[model samples]
Target chain A: MYYRALGFQKDYAWASHDDIPFSPPKIPLSQATVALVTTAVVDASIPKPVREANSYPIVDVPDHFDTSELSWDKETTHTKDRESYFPINDLRARELRQEFKALAPRFHFVPTEYSQRHTIETDAPLITRHCLEDAVDLAILIPL
Target chain B: MTARTLEAAGIATVVIGSALDILRTAGTPRVIFNDLPLGNPVGKPFDRDMQHRTVSAAFELLFSAEAPGAVKTLPHQWSTQDAWRENFMAVRAEDAATLEALGRATQATRLENKAKGLFRR
Candidate 1:
């Protein structure tokens, strides 16, 4: 409704808020350990999140991941022998070149269709702990 | 989901995706809006060089951003037209009823999976 008031159509997802948390990075880019997080349902092996209530993880590189369930055209996703929606190879190449100090021990996968409540309460803490455990300093979120 | 939480826990993040409005509303600490296809956020599939640049630019935000919720627009061009509109139209042109049904079914599947404890290891 708020988005519609701003001339956006009914299809737009709009949320009104007053205050949210904000914290700047404490380290430089070259010294940081980067991690990849995506919501494109990387592999069918990943347990799907609950409707508006949860998130899950896909361990290791999904060599056989499928990307057809997402809204994107399959032609683009399947081109050039691509499998997973997460860019593991690209991130790895950057890491190998020392673009960053290191790569996180593991990557993460979270389904995009969920409520803010679930994200803030469950998904957030899980990801934070994982990042902290792996000593990751930066996270790259690739939403579908 | 994870972006804000990571930032709050002292880790920085850069959301590289097409939905600038959604990311801002979600309070993403750092955002790099890439006007690319939905599934191809990093770059066009198999284009390693472009993908590396996209990831590099995303990481650059860690130091360049002055405040929380800093959003920068990337200059890469992955799609020729409006990405979301294109996806929506692509599905609609196929079958309107099927698209609507599939949307509902996806939500239902989530609830089903949640009940099965599939959201955890």
Candidate 2:
């Protein structure tokens, strides 16, 4: 579907070996602070300068941000519908239900136009630092 | 890279995306690959129940996945091929002319905003 969205068909090589490593949750989710992150280009609800930085900028999840730029049909997810990609509201609902100990103070939004190199080199570091600074115990990264 | 780095830093993370193959290659520790459309991974966009389920299911793996690079698929189907095409084909052929024009205009604005770091972040 992603390739079709880009109007093309291509082969993607999958890793035969599960090379990615994992770390168990340092603390139980019931006692951890959780955060949400996405590469959906959701509206930042901030100034243009801050939003358009040449380098990746970890911005706050704006209240009622627009999800139009996302690859999905905007008609369904307009400004009001965010669960399509940014599920902060769902996460919050879970929190209200005591699904987790607490919600991170902020959520993160990254542009979809970033190059893989940029994402690995620039965005990854900033995102890592931001998560660490926020003391995020668990994170949900929804890629578009 | 972000997920791997964060997990390496001792922060548990889960990736919920459609491109499971790409994500697996990228080495996402915990992944819940929903075979849904790109933008509507949580479900059919506005359906609160589906979105909530998707989120809940993804979070469930944070504890269930035992090994590094664990990947799982949710048993939810977006549609029975009747309405699924609407997602697969973003714009219908009949409405191409009209929608394409509007899309071009919107794209211009988005590009300008992106260059200026405005609009969607």
| The candidate that achieves the highest TM-score relative to the unseen native structure | 1
Supply the global lDDT for candidate 1.
0.64
For B1-121, candidate 2 gives per-residue lDDT tens digits of 6787788788899988877777877778989888876666667658888778788887789989999888888887766764654555455566566665664665586678777766332
TM, every model: 0.75, 0.72
| Chain A vs native chain A, TM-score per candidate | 0.67, 0.66
- Model 1, B8-86: lDDT tens digits are 7877778887777777786667877767655666677777777777777776776788877788787877656555444
TM-score of chain B of 2: 0.66
| DockQ of candidate 2 relative to the true structure | 0.42
- Kept native contacts, fraction for each prediction: 0.54, 0.58
Give per-residue CA lDDT, model 2, range A5-86, as digits (tens).
3333453333334577588887777888987777655444654334431222334555455555456544333435566777
Where does the lowest 10-residue lDDT sum fall in candidate 2 chain B?
Answer: B82-91
Provide the TM-score of the second chain in candidate 1: 0.72
RMSD in angstroms between candidate 2 and the native structure over all alpha carbons:
5.6
